[model samples]
Target chain A: MNDSMSTRDSLALAELVELQDVSAVAFSGQRLKPGRGSNLQLSVAAGFALTEQALSYKFDLDGSLVDVDENDPLVQLSLSLVVTYVPRNANAENWVGGDHERLKAFGDSFAWPAAYPFVREGVTAILSRLGADAYQLPMLRPSDLL
Target chain B: MRSLYERVTATLKGARAVAAARLRHEVLALLHQAQLASRMTQSDVARELGVRRSAANQVFRGDGNIRTNTLAEYLHAMGFEADLRLVRAGEPRQAALEQRAVRPAFEDWRIRRPQPTTSGVFVTNEGDDRPVLVRWAATGRTESFRVEAEVTTLPAANSFTPLGKRMFTT
Candidate 1:
């Protein structure tokens, strides 16, 4: 993640940008039969998603209680959010250089932070509703992400 | 966010691909279930249908524009039939009841709709939230490849469970 912001994060953030929108691209949470494991398996995948107006970054967060049966995710939730940003001047989508690292960096600093609250709120509400085990999505500082 | 899926569905070619993909998706599911229920293999379906193993495999894999009659024939060979039904939309509970009470929606898809084909198929391996990228050229035909840092050729559907396959002309 350190190298992610090396060339683009500053530039993307430096330019006046609008967190133009945040929308749920996908959301599904189910509470299946009780499972054996108590652990929470969490996976977070981030990437750049092009928008009509600008370039956007999307984050997918999947959390499921640890279970012996892979099919049985006692309590599971998957959320995908796209955070679109309108950067000053250029069409954000056109500005991307197709560098994977740069796009990832842009997602980390710009997309993740803006989308984190919504993600956390979503996860909290679902798990709470399901009456599943209590756990918090860690609030990671920039350095903590490294 | 505009996914490769959105990009593919935005044009006429993409519209054809979407229709084809949807049909193919349903066909593959039926093929899998029917074969499993009958304890038959693709080769068996081929033998029953008097086609090459590859041809039978093609239909099973959703590789080509398989015809409605062909789907019925394939299912008949395996001791099943395609059933299409019309249901009215209603409340969530009503919809759930209708889903259980009526015949499957897609089984009839293979029995009713005309199939579509394109120059290429966008094969999606399991775990991709959206189509990140596609590499092409398979067995002298236009097939899909995946690139998420490394470029990996798509595997056979049997080997890898493709959650979805969206086909389109270049």
Candidate 2:
């Protein structure tokens, strides 16, 4: 949000150290709701924690669709993302739990926003692969996120 | 400390509920995307679905509890064949992302092998201009490599593993 720092500079400061999944969703027996083409119940969750050398974020994009007519239930589709960005700043470790304006700015303006596209991509790809081409990730204004 | 997932689950509770919450977010996101994709106005949806303009507005802005059929109607009005179905996931939220180095080509030099399975590789510098130093825990030996064009090559640093394309620094 500040003019003094560029996104590129913030990214260069926080190198992507580890990006992986912590929560693996099980969709072994997912099915459509009894009412065909019915409405879907969807959700998204975001949270973060500070590690020894990095800032970590987790995003879970989960959806549940039910067949109100069927006795059997459908499986929920959930994608839990875990991304760790290591701040190469020598003083980064010291700022772990303390109030650090620069760190907060880096996350809000650069690191956190940088992680949005992946979630969007996940939403679109999952829907497309499932043959639900009717939907896609919502449009985002550049200023809205950064 | 409890993991981020566990912590979230502790607060939110119920995988089914969490899944539903995410679905709603995607619904809103997709509705927004659809609205933008066709340049279709809220009035257009209201006209097509035979509803008041405010009704359509509430759904798009996520003003309150949105009906599933209402959302479906919005997409349908926009010429999209949207459906609500739960299918097996073929997607993966990528795992354990790490900084990696590209293989360096040198006649008398060797490249640093990225250990995707191994851990405890230490990077000892802050920026690009500074030389990167790596110290192995078992040997306690430090290896220095000058950073060249964003790629750092280690010559005979480990002397055992192949440095794949992924720069695995665990």
Candidate 3:
């Protein structure tokens, strides 16, 4: 067996990890409504989670032969963001059930993309109202990072 | 009435969309703030990042659906390092065991604890021995100590120890 090649292969295997999906999410913040002139502020926080198998692959760089599963993800990452919206003139509307679900799905496989537009549109609308067009965020694709 | 599966699926979809939107807003807002603070025009950023001015503009406008690497590069140009932290949430027992087994005793330096949001993020001073402190938000539980600072080149091939002895340990 070629010792160097074996080590190289093992390291490559470790690097060949993929992002599966947002396993879970928890966030705290309020919703910004359309048609209301409001100032919005947000803080984005992200975290990472790794399985035991993935951990083994990372530190066990001794070129030792070990079982490798292509289908399993070595790590899971969680992104939590909180957006605070202050209305310029008017009391805030009552919070509803959909808000909780909105936060939960932020980490879900199917719902993340669907919810992106709402925030974008909200920002655009509010900024347009304020006559400030300078702020914008780059669109991010989760799969590409994997 | 909708089927249970159908309802659950719809709800999940709604939640995902909202969460994604919020994340997008936060990221864009931060980038915008960074751009203002740096006072570097889109062209300036493009030159530094080696992209076209138009491409830099697209990123600023939030039109680019950026990949993680691209985002890291953008942040790097602006003098910030993107650090994503992942901590095992449910497995307290496993976390404890790993913590005890892996961490080395060090006094002068300590691994920055993961924040309520994310932790162990550092900005490079751009010194010769730019101490790189890597915390595995996903995998590695241990943070390293900086025993000493030495000059070395990163290997392109299969050399066992990579970048031997820098200002910081990883």
Off by over 4 Å in 1: A1-9, A12-16, A35-37, A67-72, A90-97, A143-146, B1-170
Q: Which residue pairs of candidate 1 clash?
A: none
Q: Tell me which of candidates 2 and 3 scores higher on TM-score.
A: 2
| Tens digit of per-residue lDDT, candidate 1, span B34-118 | 9999999888888888999998888877876778898899999999998645433223225445775533323443333221111
What local distance difference test score does each model get? 0.59, 0.49, 0.37
Model 3: lDDT equals 0.37
lDDT of 2 by residue, B66-130 (tens): 88677777888987756444432211111212334322233222435533322323244555432
Residue runs of model 2 more than 4 Å from their true location after superposition: A1-29, A34-41, A64-76, A90-97, A100-106, A142-146, B1-170
lDDT of 3 by residue, B1-170 (tens): 97553454477675466546655765677677777777878788899988999888888788857666777787778876654433332232344557854232243334464332122222344753332322223323356323322222221112221111111001
lDDT of 2 at A99: 32
Model 2 scores a C-alpha lDDT of 0.49
lDDT of 1 by residue, A42-142 (tens): 67766664433345666667778655446456887888766655444434455445455555555656667778888777777777677775556668577
Per-candidate interface C-alpha RMSD?
A: 18.0, 17.9, 17.1
Model 1: which docking level applies? incorrect
Measured over all alpha carbons after superposition, the RMSD of each candidate to the real structure, in angstroms, is 23.1, 27.4, 31.9
- Which has the greatest TM-score? 1
